[model samples]
Target: LQKLRSGQDFNSSHQYPQLLPRRHCGKGLIDGEKSTPSATLYEFPWIAKLFNRALGYNCLGTLISHRYILTSENCINFYFIPDLIVLGEYDNFREPDCQLEDPTDCAPPLRLYEVEYVVRNHNDYRYRIDLIRTTENVAFEDHIQPVCLPLTSELKHFRPSQYTIAGWNKNSKNTTGIIQKETIYAASSAECQINEEHLPHNVLLYTTSHENVANRTYSGGPVGAIVPSSERRFVQFALVISPVERCVVALDIVPYIDWIRANMVE
Candidate 1:
């Protein structure tokens, strides 16, 4: 908390060289996911890709700690198969993307970390909560970092507003390491029920625009509010449970802060 408030380094050094933005130009591996048209380096440093080792389904997740991953319980409830996570990857087709001549260029190495533990809150179909721990500490880099789990006081100020989210592209039939994102607005309970059929009180909506993304399988993607008065940092507010054409329903994270804090490793 002190490090976040002070803008100081927490678990790792908090500085990096300049990064250049690159546009994406590729189809996804399935019918739903598609690569982003334009992506910037270090833009979304905390998004993780969850891949089912046994089958071919993939979900998005958020790194809240060096070893803890927060995602939707529904993503893992159907099958108890193992999941591997890919972090800090941009182009799904390429690996070790060396944009600059210098090896010191700030791109992170491609990695696939295995899950070692799992916890799901299944009090109801509404919970939609899941917490996963990596087999080992994830290597931090410029393009890969953990997102902040805001203090309860900070989350309380989260007004219904614009937010950003990231997910894997499954539109194409080829497997890639790309992670795409979109801009959506937080909707009220009334608005949520309007777009989605039936959602519990613990869920909210993030609606899309006309030039919106083709909503595919983006479950477990991080839905975060850009700090209303803070710097270029974002604090996670929810986790996606379902993504549709014009709207995405996410489980609120604010209500589970204590549960998360107790399980996370420093």
Candidate 2:
């Protein structure tokens, strides 16, 4: 707490180039879980809650950098406009969110940032992605950090057999703000074609959910893939575009990796 208050270096990239092996990307979640369940305190730290002017959480976004958030164009569409972005938050109802298993273990207070502006992809582009710039650079901590983007050549072509989708439970009965996760597998070409969803000749990458996304609103949520050979590090390869009944459609991050990097600056 003192370190966080005093603004001490919590192993920034310069101090530890790898963002500290302890809090690397996708470090949370115990191994071996097949069903959707409430996530642990520090799982998916990059998940950001988007809030509108009314101060209500509207959608989900991913922390891709200290100053930028990666979201979907639909989030800032005609109906919803997320003006505030909250990080390091596990439960919306409580501050200094603590672990359910261990009351003594708690995360730091959630950090809120005002959105400076939003940049949308070219109107001609088929994918719907938006980059949000925050007024201030978010401080990185154990419970708040950026996720790994697919920038390397290997990651660009890499595909995992199983993917993880993490976001808040939108069920009216359970609005505790406890983050949840579901495991989804890559749909075969026959399944993708069955939907009759056509993509541009150049845009050949995408995935669909096998079952309902646990009734969770994955709009702007992260579709994470486990990195091979890494120490359980997960990479953000896609963002949830929409949920169609029991099937969820997502846009591949590889197509927008360069666009994201180019617009990361203010």
- The TM-score leader among the candidates is 2
Candidate 1 Cα errors over 4 Å, as ranges: 1-37, 78-80, 98-106, 173-178, 188-197, 210-215, 228-230
Model 1, residue 35: what's the lDDT?
A: 42
Instruction: Count residue pairs with overlapping backbones in model 2.
Output: 0
Candidate 1 residue-wise lDDT, 1-266, digit = tens? 11011111222243332121111101111212324533454567677777776775567788776787788877775464336887876666666654322445547576889877676654555655777778898877667777766564845566646776766566657544455567788665565446345667888777877243443546887787555442445677788887755777788878676556544554
What C-alpha lDDT values do all the predictions have?
Answer: 0.63, 0.70
Expressed as tens digits, the lDDT of each residue in 1-266 for candidate 2 is: 11001112122232222221224455555545534477888887889988887758767899877788888777776466677898998876677799887889999898889887777776455657788778898888889878887767987788788788877777758466788777766664455553345654232223444456537778888888778764767788888876655555677767676556555543
Q: What is the C-alpha local distance difference test score of candidate 2?
A: 0.70
TM-score of each: 0.74, 0.81
Q: For residue 119, give model 1's deviation from the true position in Å.
A: 0.9
The TM-score, computed over Cα atoms with residue i paired to residue i, of candidate 2 is 0.81
Model 1 vs. true fold: TM: 0.74
